[model samples]
Target: MSGRILIVDDDPVQRRLLEEAVTRFGYSSRVVENGVEALQVLRAPEGGDIDLVILDLVMPELDGYAVLEKMRGDGNSTPVIVQTAQAGIDTVVGAMRAGAQDFVVKPIGPERLEVSIRNVLKVSALEDEIVRFRKSAAGTLTFSDIITRSPSMERVIRLGERAASSHIPILIEGESGVGKELIARAIQGQSDRAAKPFVTVNCGAIPENLVESILFGHEKGAFTGAVDKHVGKFQEAHGGTLFLDEVGELPLDVQVKLLRALQEGEIDPVGARRPQKIDFRLISATNRRLMDLVKEGRFREDLYYRLNVFPIWIPPLRDRLEDIPELTRHFLARFAAEEHKSKVSTVAPETVALLQSYDWPGNIRQLENAVFRAVVLCDDTCLRPDDFPQVQANCASRGAGGGQGGEPRIDAPLIAGEPAIRPDDAAGERSGEHAGAAALWKAQGSFAGFTDGSVPFGFLRALDRNGHVQTLECVERDMIVTAIDHYGGRMAEVARRLGIGRSTLYRKLKDYGLEASNGQDAAE
Candidate 1:
């Protein structure tokens, strides 16, 4: 509540108004005339001290959208609310799309302005709490358990902690399979309301017509399927946390109702005469670009602001491979314990290196699944590379030939192909000369078998060493391709074998460069 508020606008009067509003709420405020000035302040050594930004959409030097874009692009997650004298659907949509937390049209009324500021501040506090919780739980949670150690992830954890501590609404953004729901749970677990029920409702999974009833509890005769009184997620999570997963999937009407609930802290049960008050923390997650949806006129701008009081983003796995070793160990331990098996306790160091090399499009969940699969199929005390056949096959197909880190080293021989020259062989032969190259190749892989027409055992050995480390995307792509080829390119069979939707398979095929004929080819 005592945080600094940055006012960014070309108009002095508007800045004064916002300053007064912020001061009235007992917060310190500063005014900047344009995005350039704001960036100057933000980039200062002490710039990060500014807690929230009240940005103006239209300014002389740099507009509000440009300011938001610069801040977000630089990895600054400071909460932002945009204000503009010109009010229009396009303006509101553009502001939100630019990553503004909320948008306020010009001629700002004191009440509306105060409410927006308070909402954004409340959410910021919650995000701070999430960060604290994550830092505290770092060692306890495995990389596979949480999946990120990047600066971005650390910031998200902190923000999530803050969100969990406050009663304000929260919005989490990321791509599909980025573990948005997991972050929501972590927030709930760290909140004061952890003792109470933690309810989750997938907006995308519910029918459009029934979404309201699902969210607002219904009377026995509320609808055709309402045979008895039913409690909605909000009511069920009373005195606790209510997680709205895939919130962007909600219809415009439902979003409006949801906004009302956030504003009033109450809900009106279907077929009921009176509204019932509910005390619950609202946490929402979405993979879709909600601001884009707003720009396309598919989402309400007001609702977007209401839900995004506090926004947290979870980064994809490729950006944070440093955490893979910890994640792999974590998942292996979890699955081993769950299955009451001691044989699958540890992974080979080479396997860890292999996994660290690949990109994890499916993030933590995919890693967990792969570990579980390996555990289930292992026949010996030590889980080896062959235990994860799909992963090894995929790595082999990549022409990696082998190495510990993500990239294949030049020294490694092609085990599946004819033997080739290895760096180690040359290094030993020319001990006095080319020492650096020999060492580099040796550290990367021993190139012994390549010169002799026979493939080196090190190639297979490297695969055996680092098999556990292949990322979920690589493994999944390899599995899908294998299934497709095995089934003679039968789409339906491939989907069934992969345990995914046909549509999902098609999408994966396109993503992995397998859909060459569908005009969805992957970029070269």
Candidate 2:
């Protein structure tokens, strides 16, 4: 919806019409008299900005088919929509076989052209997401997976590559949500253990009592709840990499054990007779400074020295503002596909400017959630600055000398017909549209699913009115119902977007006794 389109045609009138239509549809256009000039633009360094090609199939010298072949041969995967006056089936087949994503007849209607462009861009985004997910799942993810055009990030990548070259203990230092685990995964993926297991343990999330048992394994009957033998994370990551996230949160007792394991290359499981050797690489990350903890005597000085052997500090998102545009586009594509919002193609330039102005305290994770919410709320083909109400309100408040430290304060409700109140306002202050927006903060409680805050308008709740944790089945059922309602009972689209088979969707629908809501869809 918001990309630079290249128009390749020899007819001046056709070229003018196409450019005007593309511009009217909210996309920029570049005109080329023929395929020769089109190829010249695409092969240039700046050609990367061209997102789609509207090539004329019956050109003078280089036809659209020849252009497609040349582009494919040069490893250019930019999508193309070939157009011709001839509407023959053979013409369509030849264009498709030659690497065109879509075909259109000349003198096309504006609506048809717009739909083709949107579909092509959406499919391209989905394909890119699939490739990246496959690579990460296969442990083939590398520094290339990280999206950044910042020099600071490049320096961090250089350090990461150096750390990946050898089996050296690495300590990645970054703020929460700055993608520490991603960097650790990239290190493991680039190392010799590419296809091996990459186990992650959130040191901060574990209970203090189970830290040792979880890290060093436990034999059956080792404790009151140890009814079965358990293999600890270290053993589970044997022959691969063990990523200890938030390593600074490890208890002092566990720190000593970890230090011993690192030094001796072995661990003694609970109730074990002898120590078992481990052959896994260690990659630890922490948002807190371990040296400060060591100074405060909360962390073991010796263990700190051992873990900080090759420290890599990743700068926060605010320091590298140049990456916001690229990151926002990436998140937009991914969430658009997942939410089935094909119309939400690109972010407006004003939205980009607003995003870059605010310092993302929650970093990339917050940005991702923001885009997801925007896509869900968007009714048009593009995301405008108005879509990010929280960010807009934050910027307004900052100008008025209020609200800092990444806490979002909404001046108004995110959507129409919602009751909201300011955080500082008195208890019975809930009112209509004039009331403040959802002033959500960065927390790890009920909103664990989202980084910034819980979903707006109570789409999903982790707890009930009685303040108890919701059962998994109950939550899942509610989620499916919400999605069904959100997507208007389009069963196939719902199932595909939810990443579930139709049979499985039907089963869940039957179990929830909601099949009658869409009997027509269920019958199919």
Candidate 3:
């Protein structure tokens, strides 16, 4: 739910006021003096990151309407909230027709503005999620749809891309909830057989007696339960991709038939007179190591070799910590929209830090459920550490290197480890969140201290040493330091970015004792 907002207004006072309101509401903001500057920011490569735009109708060069028209014409669907001094119906209708998501009158109340922003972001997130899922179900999902910022994942995508260029069997190896099936689907979506039936079969979930019948079509009266003819998963996926999930769990007897199917590109039904040829791509996934299963004689060696032609091993969530922030934001937006939690739109940095500290044994799936629960139960606009008691407890337990049975020691700021769980919690915590948890992954290395002054994104410490919220002056000073470092000591750029004049910036720099460290101003 966290997003950067772009504020476009000719009035300096209005821009400053809007920036402060946005910051106070736990969002980041950028201010542009006119529509021209706004478009410059929007059209910049970085503009894609802006979540919402608060536009003023009356501008010197490019007006709000013009900006909106240009944005829609260029297919830039970024959400916009147009604000004007005039509250006339004509203005509202015109804004909406021009593709503005919402309209606000000048001097809008803080509460009204907050609500409008939340609703707009929620709708946008839900719309995007719907479109993505529709594409996935229609067998058109591509690697571009996969979200990951981790280098390890980049390698995986490169391999998948290479594998997709031809009909080589791919075996995706990963822990449960690590998105093995998603990788399979993306490969199919990118291959020549894309848009064809991408049928899936959970090999482990089917009864052993029916495995052959379910995978290879059976004729009527083929078996006692075969009262009618039925097309099997393999036949249904003809000329497309057949994803066999949990392939390591396939019964030893069925492995022989699966091996034959892959070897000869054909399948023999349970009681068919002739073997049927199938022109389909084969993609298999497993949480267990197929090699280990092969060594144990649980899986066939030939089939293992065939499926392992192109192996893609996805790292667990604990190894991709950098992706947590973006993944959390994605889920926060989607779940908030689905659950109608209009007020829950962002997570406090401490909450994110606490989440990053935990070891997600269930991987991305667990993190997705954790965020969904937090959003559903959160009553405020921002999620704080208090909102995640279970996560905090889990991290504390793991940090101590033991679980409930360890010799416990008294600790300050005691928190109840177990939060009350509702019966409805079952539905929200399922692994289906894996589809979107697509981006959530494990930290690359051991857990790092969040307060060691190395936290990513240069976030100021949320709480003071005494565990209380830091004062505004202290936070302001840290923000200036962060800005100085981010802007490479360009005082003018810092002043402009912070929405302050040169005099005010210098005054604050001196008051905060930052001048000496920032003496080498690139643009004094």
Best by TM-score: 2
**Across residues 1-524, which tens digit of lDDT does each residue of candidate 1 receive?**
33568999888888888888778655678888889999999989657667789888888878888889999898888899888778889888888888888888888888788777756654554455455446434412222235444677878887877776687788888866677877877776676765567788987667667888989989998778789998888899898778898777677787887888988999988887889999988888886678877887767899999888888888877677766655665566556666877545455555666676555545666666777888898876545677766556545644455532222344534544534433221100111232223332343354433343333222322232344444667646645654454344556434544544354666688778877743322221
lDDT of 2 by residue, 1-524 (tens): 44679999999999999999998777779999998999999999768778799999998999888899999999999999999999999989999999999999978999999889877876876777788788788887899777777889989999999999999999999877798988988998899999898999988667668889999999999989999999999999999999999787788888988998899999999988899999889999987778877887878999999999999999999899978877887788898878888778877777888999887767888888888888988998888988888777667766776543223345565334433423321111112421122332223224445455554432345565566777989877766765564345666545544545355677798888877754634432
TM values, all candidates: 0.50, 0.71, 0.70
Q: Native-vs-model 1 lDDT?
A: 0.67
After superposition, candidate 3 runs with Cα above 4 Å error: 10-13, 31-45, 147-162, 223-225, 329-346, 379-382, 399-524
Model 1 error, position 8 (Å): 56
Candidates' RMSD to native: 22.6, 14.1, 21.4
When 1 and 2 are scored with TM-score, the better candidate is 2
Error of 2 at 444 (Å): 29
lDDT winner between 1 and 2, please give it: 2
Q: lDDT (CA) for every model shown? A: 0.67, 0.79, 0.76
Q: Which tens-of-lDDT digit does each residue in 1-524 have in candidate 3? A: 35789999999999998999998777779998988888889899778778899999989888999999988887789999999999999989999999999999989999999888877877777777787788799888888777667779989999999999999998898877788888888898888888899999987667667788889879999978789998899999998999998787677788888889888989998778999999989999877778876887767898899889989999988798866876887788888877988678777877878887865756788788888989878988888887777777655754775332121223322223322212111112222222221111112011323423333332245456566666899868866776665555666546545654345677898887776765734344
Alpha carbon lDDT of residue 47, candidate 2? Answer: 87
Candidate 3 TM-score over all chains jointly: 0.70
